[model samples]
Target: MTQQTSGEMRIEKDSLGEIAVPAGHLWGAQTQRSIECFPIGTARFVWRRPVIRAFGILKKSAAIANGELGQLPADKVAMIVKAAQSVIDGDVDEEFPLVVFQTGSGTQSNMNANEVIANLAIRNAGGKLGSKTPINPNDDVNRGQSSNDTFPTAMHIAIVEEISRDLFPAVTQLRDTFERKGRQFDDVVMVGRTHLQDATPVTLQQVFSGWVAQLDEALAAITATLPALYALAIGGTAVGTGINAHPRFGDVTAAKIAAETGHAFISAPNKFAALSAHDAVANTSGAIRTLAGALMKIANDVRWYACGPRAGFNEITIPENEPGSSIMPGKINPTQCEALTMVAVQVFGNDAAVAFAGSQGNFQLNVFKPVMLHNVLESTMLISDACRAFDTFCAKGIEPNRAKIETNLKNSLMLVTALNPHIGYEKSAKIALLAHKEGSSLKEAALNLGFVTEQEFDAWVIPADMTHPLPE
Candidate 1:
């Protein structure tokens, strides 16, 4: 017979040939039921280790506080915390195997974590598997926490960790790359486009600067949403009233979380409101949507600018890494930009899903936790990957077509910047219209106007200097 310890469950191999459920834990029934019931999405919540660990931290903190205040051993809290840290560090991923689709309430996930931590603690105390000898799931493993509060709190912690460790840094690197390119091309003149029509002359740097500005706005929006995420629903319990938990549990658990993660997370001001709502998730989703929009703009711009070797914009040439087409040999496509745009589109879709999920909250809780977490985490990972790929494959390797830039600049009627110094806006507009209507150059138009001498026209019509304010 399998020996049992407090919080330990008997180890059983699933159909996937994976070891799970070491006996004696409260989560065994739920995990087994989840495996048997909803097997919709093959994907598991594998990357949610941070969230799981956050749950573990809260549980351990509550247990310790409860033990100190009432009836339990001091070392029980340490055992649970150490067990949770092991899982957090990815030492035992196979131990968790719940379907991504459950009640959508995240109860299964919370229970799974409680069971795993409890069992690991029991084993650490030299107890046999499936035995709840040292750590009880309710009294010790999940002392002062409830799934309602723990789920959202853990979700916020996970998202914030990912944003700080991965998403923001990736965006910063990409932004720096664009800024460097902007400086590099500061002197390169190109025809500026409006409504797909040549409207004026501008430096390539100016065009790139527009992209940088958009990225900067995206970064700011993302940063602004972090504060909302930091305010967690730790002590909310079932419906945000500390129901069966200590009054100080939320604040103290949040403090422990902050200390462990190095992020300044705090308990929500109103536990009741937090447990019943998903404002943090919605706000963060908006930030991700903003990022997606910026990325879409940047990628579309690059693809359009790199469109043609013989037909499209052809103003800029993208580096050809591999043969773009199998059938059409020698054809190179904007694959990197295409990928980025595709990811942006997916992020937008995810944002919509998150919004809908967040809005569907019923009275005491929202049952859309699984979908919300999946989409949010997906958006984070995809954005990071797309930014890195775009930076390396598209942005870093981009080269301006100098001949094309010069030709487009020369052909544009908006070279009126040179004429603006001598003539006012109306006169410059007339000269531009005449140039376009009669198919004449700006110099010819100015000559016909008798506004300036040919030498004066030639000296003033420098396309490179047309983008800035005319000399005073």
Candidate 2:
């Protein structure tokens, strides 16, 4: 809703020159320059709520640290902190109008936040908006910090917050659902497929167990990356030298951030590495990529398992929540699984973008902060939402097609593998081949070939036991 026509305009000036800014907008010159300079996409940083909130939190923390250090007066610090709180509460989302494709260093976004917070502080303190008198964007709001460090710090904090607050719980819920299904289907045995061909007898519970394990591993890997991410890149200022930043700034700001976020936020051990490289973020992206792979596998498994009532695997029926087809009658697609799979693909894409962005760090700063943060935050939100959706829409509603499972289990030639321990591999293979050739059950083929007695076949060919074999 930018006034493309004749709305009131205000003049804002930066180091470059004066520009016509929207009259009511809180963002000032740098943000205005970014708006006019790079009209790349309508996509703005407004969608990145976590990043913005983290920026707010970082600003508030910095103000507190600076105030305690006597760098800024207490009144201005209080005003800045309150303004930053407004940002955290999402009271001024419209104030931030910069896009993710702005300067690679995210200086524009940093200024956007500074300007918004400063104007709000001015208004709260009974001063005029756009009057940077007591609450200057640079001297007060952005004191002792630079986009080089603060942006990356915000990126890390936001991602860590999203993962801990949202994504981990969603994934854990999905994992727990899989565990529930595992126990529920413990005795329901079916033919296990490898390379899309029958391989051995496996209980449905065991398949679910494997799924739970995959999710567990993925969640564990993602969680393991948190410690690295908790190390903030703040207080490094323009470069790794700590420039105008106080020596106490890094630790105090980190402590304040940790207090606000409820996460263990630590100052980066090496400011140079934190500012100049984004390997931690890259490691996080890699973890998410691994989780995406797991989700893709699980979603595809569910989709394939619920494929058809008359054609495919058809061993489970997903809940019919909506009419799946326009013309076809009584059609219920595995839409949730399809959605989850698509999300997995999208996360994969986001991770690729994040990985590439993370590597784009040149010398004293990574210029790809905005895109990196956008992609990482997008991946976190998508995966979290997809996990929740898959759990509620698909996992919770899965119905075992016991009749089909039994039918397939009874007819499967791979059941002969269960007889290997008792009858030897060669004889088992022969029995399996005979069953396939004659279109007979392994039991029937074994009986015809006199490979074993009925009593022995019944004793040794228990599918449930095959899922968890007692040590030979």
State each model's CA lDDT, in order.
0.79, 0.87
Backbone clash total, candidate 1? 20
Q: If scored against the real structure, what TM-score would every candidate get?
A: 0.91, 0.96
User: Against the correct fold, how does model 2 do in TM-score?
Assistant: 0.96
Per-residue lDDT over 311-338 for candidate 1, one digit per residue giving the tens place of the 0 to 100 score: 8779888778778888998999999988
- Off-target runs (Cα >4 Å) in candidate 1 are 1-27, 63-72, 417-421, 424-430, 449-451
Name the candidate that leads on TM-score: 2
- Measured over all alpha carbons after superposition, the RMSD of each candidate to the real structure, in angstroms, is 4.6, 1.6
True-structure lDDT of candidate 1: 0.79
